[model samples]
Target: PTAPVAAAAAALCVLAVSPGQAWAASADGPDGPAAYETAEGAKPVKGTAGSGDGPEISPGTYTDSIGRGEKKYYHVDLDAKSSAFISAVAAPEPGSRVKGVGEGLKIRLETVDGSECDGGTEPQFSAEGAAYPVADYATRLIGADDECQKAGAYLFSVEREGPETSDPGRWPLELRYMSEPGLKGGPRLLPGSPDSDEEPGDDETPAPVTSGEKRQAHGGTGFNDAGALAKGVWRDRIKPGETRFYRVPVDWGQRLNASVELGSANSPGEYPPTIYDGFGITAYNPARGRFEDDPFVSYTPDESAQAAVYTPTVDYTSRFDYSTNTPCLAGWHYLAVTVSPQLGKFFKSTAPLTLRVDVTGTAKAGPKYAGDAHAAGFGVSDEDKEQAEKGQNAAEGERSDSLRIVAYVGIGAGVVLILGLAVWTLTARRRAEALPGAPGTPGALGGPAGPGGQAGPDGGSGTV
Candidate 1:
C-alpha cells in the first residue's frame, strides 16, 4: 500500500485502541454521586454508596454530587483513640424554595448500631436569603463522655434538613473527613476539648453597656440604622431578621478584632431537643460592601447545654490597597449581627447578643500621592475613585479549566498521531527491503524469479 494509506491504517489502529485505554483508565475514576477514595479500585470497590449498607469510606476528601431527598451514607471505622471530623460543602441551588421554614443540610455521626455519637446538628441559614456554596461541618471527639466510642463501623450520613421541596437540583457535594488519632496510651485531654478544665478568665473586660447604662438606643430598627457601637464590649438584643449595624471609625494602620456572644434566655429543658437557632456576624467595609475573603462567623446553638452563650470572634487587618480593598479598608466599617429565628424554637423571641470591638495599632495616614486630595475615603485609592466616578464594576476572572483539559487532550492526540505515522513508515520500509530482488535477493523486481521460483515475490504470491 501507499505510504499515505499505510499511515491512515496505523492511525485507525491507534484510534481504535485509544478509546479502550481511555475507558480502562476511567472505569473506576472519581466521577460518581458520592465521590471518595477507596483501598481497592480494580476489584472495583464502590466510591458512591447512599444506603445504610453503603460502602466503607476512609478518612479523606471526596468530591461528590447529590440531589434533593437523596441520602448518601459512608461508614468510617474508628477506634477508641481516634476522633472524627466530617464536613460537606455544596452550593445552594438557585430558585429553590422552602415549604415553610428552610433548613440547611444535616450531617450526623452515628455508631454501628445507629446510635448518634455527636448530637447530629444541621447547618443554619436564613430561609429567605442565604448564599450558596456554604461550608457545613460537624465534629465528634471520642472521650469519656461519648458512650458510643466502640471500635467498629460508624456511619456518616448527609441529607437535606427539611422536606425535599425546600431545595432541589443535583448540587455538587464535597465531603471531607479527618480522623485524628489520639495520643497513644491512657486518657488524654485535647487542648480544645470540651471537657478541658480551663475556666473562663476571671479578669474579663467589662462590657460597654453594662445592662445598666442606658444604651444610646440607636434603636437600630434595621440594618441601615444599625446602632453606632463604639470600640468597646457592648450588649444588645436582636429579633428575628432584625439586623443591628454598628459602624466603628477604623483609621488606617489599625487592626480590629470583634466578637459577638449569643445568650440563651431559656433553660435547658425549656425548648424541644430539635429546636435550634443561628446567629450570623458579618463585617462590611466602610462602604457597607462585602470584602472578598472576609471572615463570616456563624454559630448555631442546639439543646446540648454547656452555657447559655456562643461567642465567635472575627479579626481583620486595616491595610490600604486598591486591590482586595474590602477586608483591608478603614473608616466607618460596619458590623452587622442578624438572627435567623426558628419559628417554634427557643430563639423565637428576642435573643440577647453581646458585641465587643477592640482596636489596636497606631493610626497612620495613607500614602501621599498626586491624586491623594481626591481620594474617595480612608482606604479607597485614586484609581478606585476614578472607577467609582465612572460607575464601573470590577471585571470577573475567567474560568478556563475545561479549555485547558481540552488542550491537553489535543496535545496527547497529536503525539499519538506522530508515533503512529513513524511506526507505519518504518514498517513500510522494512517490508519493501525484504521484497524479492529488491537489492540482494535472487529474484528480479519486474520478473521475480528466485531459485525456488514458486511465487510472484519472496517465494510467495504478490497478494499481501
Candidate 2:
C-alpha cells in the first residue's frame, strides 16, 4: 500500500451474448453459488431447475499424481450427443495435510491446442470437499450456441496455503460422468467414461498420461491435515509469524485472484493477544517462483465458520483479508476469489464469491480491441480449464499507475475507431449515390430522402 499497486481479481461473470440469462441449481450436486457467498448484501439467491441433462462423459473417471511442484490437467472429449464436466470431489493425497478455506485445491480449464481461452463457453471445473469445506467459489457458464460441438478440459493442482506439506496422497477419488439428470454412479467404479464403449470394468481408472515423468515438485493442501497433522484451518501457530506462504501452479504470467477466511482467540495472559487469522496483503511473483514467502499480511480470526467475506483485487504482491475489529470480528469465515477465466469453463463449477474484479484499473489493459481477455497466457484459461484455480490475488491491494497508462491507451483507441468508422460509412454512401442514374439527393443512403428531394426508382438511382 506504500506505492500505487497493480489490481487483479477473477469473478463469476456471465458471458452471455443472448437475451435474458437463466441461473439454476446444479442437479449434478446439492451445493452451489448463493450458499458460498462471504460478502454482505452480495449473497446470491437460490436457484431453480435447469436445461440439458448431462451427456455421458467419454473418459468417465481419471486420476493424476500432481507432484510437489506440478499442475496436472485432463480432457473430456464430447461426441455429437455427449458432453462432460470435471469436478474435484476428493482431496489430492492426504499427505499434504491441506485444509480450510481456499487452501488445498485450485481448478482450471484449457483448450486441446493449449491456447486461447477467454472465449470460454462451457462447464468450468468446480470443487466439493468431504469435510463440509466450501469449494470457496465455483463458476457457472451460460450456454453457448455451439456447445455440443466444442471440447472441454480440466486442470487439477495442489495448493498449500493453510497447513503445509509436499506429499501427494494416494486416496482413490471418485470422478464420474452422469448421462442424465436422474442417473447415479455405480457402487464400484465403472470402466471408462459412460461415453466410452470400452468398459475397463473396475474401480481402477488410471490417467492417460502416467506419473513420475517430468517430476515438477510443488505444494498442495486439503480439507483435513488428517494425514499430516490434527489441525484443519489456517494458522501461523504451527509455523508462527505475521508472514505466511502459499503457491499454485500456472502457465506463467497469468492473472490470479485469491482470498482467505480468518479467526483467532485469547491466551492465558496478554502476550499482545496472540494474532491468528487470514492475511490482508501479500507479495508474490513467478521470478521468485512458486513455494516461497507469499505477499500476505498476518491475520487473526475472531470466530470460526462464522462466515466472513473478503473481496480482493489482489496483485502479484498485494494481499486481501477479513476484519477482526469488534464490529468486524473475524472467525471461521469464507473467502472466494477467482484466479483467471481467460481459459473458459475451467471456473464454471468453483461457485466463486460474487464480486467481479475490474482488472481494468490495475490489469495490463489489453490491446484496446473489442475482444475480451484472450491474450497469450494472460486470461483465466478456458482453453481447457484456464484451472480456471487460476491463482487468486488479494482484493485489498491498492491501485497502481500502470492502470492509468492502460486507460489512456483505451481512450485513444476508441477515438481512432470512431474516426475510422465515420470515414468508411461516408465513402460507402457516396459510392451508392454516384451510381449511374442514381438520385442526386444529399442523403441518398439506406433510408428515405427529404421531401422535395428527388428519389430514383428502387429508392436509388441505380435501379436494376
The top-ranked prediction according to TM-score is 1
Give lDDT per model, in order.
0.47, 0.26
Would you give me the overall lDDT of model 2? Answer: 0.26
Total residue pair clashes for candidate 1: 3
Model 2 off-target regions past 4 Å? 1-65, 73-75, 79-84, 89-106, 115-266, 278-305, 309-464
**Which residue segments of model 1 deviate by more than 4 Å?**
1-52, 94-102, 127-129, 188-464
Tens digits of lDDT, candidate 1, 200-255:
33223233223333233232422223445444456666555444545555545554
Candidate 1 weakest lDDT stretch, 10 residues: 306-315
Question: Model 2 misses residue 356 by how many Å?
Answer: 25
Error of 1 at 46 (Å): 7.9
* lDDT score at residue 61, model 1, on the 0-100 scale: 54
TM-scores, all candidates, are 0.36, 0.24
